[model samples]
Target: MSKIKLLLAEDEPALGQIVKESLETRDFDVTLCADGQEALQTYTDHQPAIVVLDVMMPKMDGFTVAKEIRKVDDTIPIIFLTAKSQTSDVVEGFSIGGNDYVKKPFSIEELIARINNLLNRSLEQKNADTLKIGEYIFEFPKQVLRFRESEQNLTHREAHLLFHLYKNKNQVLDRSLILKKLWGDDDFFSGRSMDVFITKLRKKLKEDPAISIVNVRGYGYKLIC
Candidate 1:
């Protein structure tokens, strides 16, 4: 089997080298970039399976790189490495299409664990068939929602949120559980962002009046069909 390819973007030369070497030890083909621009270029060229981005970079910030990457590929897993542990920063990362947020000074083991978890989840998604939701067909791997001949492309997070709701159709999923599952953390800002994505999902799934995502006040949501 081919080794999993990883793109590591960090301005700190020493840390980047250490991370690259460590990941390589675990059978990953690591491509290290010093700045956001180079990171973006490498990402395009290599099409790595996963990306580890440092929040603070020279040419462009990690958030900007994540946003740009999302434009090109919404499903690629992105893990942000940042010293900033602020809730706002975490929320921003998720809002801009990040799959995971790792605070700086983290252990290599933790990072490796996160990578494996995400990769496994992604693989599972790929093997799953399209799901039927009312009149729409939700394609998990493609992050698309199709109704009749019309189709709508969704962001990674949007598709993930919708899938979880659909999986628990007619049940009220706790808000905290949704936040923890999707964002990896249940914070105030993350909850607010979840609300925003719920709205977006509602809008996208609105073509079928029979399908409704009901907001269970003080709780989470339910996908009714």
Candidate 2:
């Protein structure tokens, strides 16, 4: 099998080389960029399996890079490397679509472990096939929802959220739980994003009047058909 490609964005030259060499030793194909703008360009060109972004970088910060990446590919896993250990910083990372946050001076072994674990989880999610949701057939891998001859292609976030709701169809899912599961935190920003996704799902499913994602007031939501 081909080695997994990883995009590493770090402005520090010595650290960038060290990481690139280390990951190459472990059978990974690494594309190292020295600044955020270069990182973004490399990402667009390479489309690596995973992204490792340093929070402090020239041109743009990791947060900004993550936001831009999310606009194009929401499912690609992003790991933030930063010296900032503040709770707010961590929350902000997740809110911008980061899959994991690793502090600076982190052990390469631990970083590798986190990368492997996330890759495995992502792979498993991609392996899921079609699922029945009301009268619609959710094609998880394709990010498509189909009903009869009509179909709607969904964004990665939308498809992921809908998958969870369909999994618990007819059952109320706690709002906070869903937020934590998808966004890694239940903060206000993540909550608001979840609400947006819920609205999008409702709009997508509106073609089938019998299908409804009901808001459970102060609790959560339920997919009722």
Winning candidate number (lDDT): 1
TM-score of 1: 0.86
Query: Candidate 1 residues 1-225, lDDT tens each?
Result: 899999999999999999999999999999999999999999999999999999999999999999999887867889999999987788788778788899989999999999998888777776765999999998987888999999999888888888888778999988898797677678776778788999999999899999999988988899998
lDDT of each: 0.89, 0.88
How does model 2 score by TM-score? 0.74
Writing each residue's lDDT as its tens digit, candidate 2 over 100-153 gives 989988999999999998898678667767887778889986789998998899
Per-model root-mean-square deviation over C-alphas: 2.5, 3.5
Please, what is the TM-score per model?
A: 0.86, 0.74
Model 1 Cα shift for residue 7 (angstroms): 0.6
- Candidate 2: Cα lDDT at 146: 97
Question: What's the lDDT of the predicted structure labeled candidate 1?
Answer: 0.89
**Stretches of model 2 off by over 4 angstroms after superposition:** 86-88, 141-143, 153-156, 167-177, 192-196, 199-203, 206-225
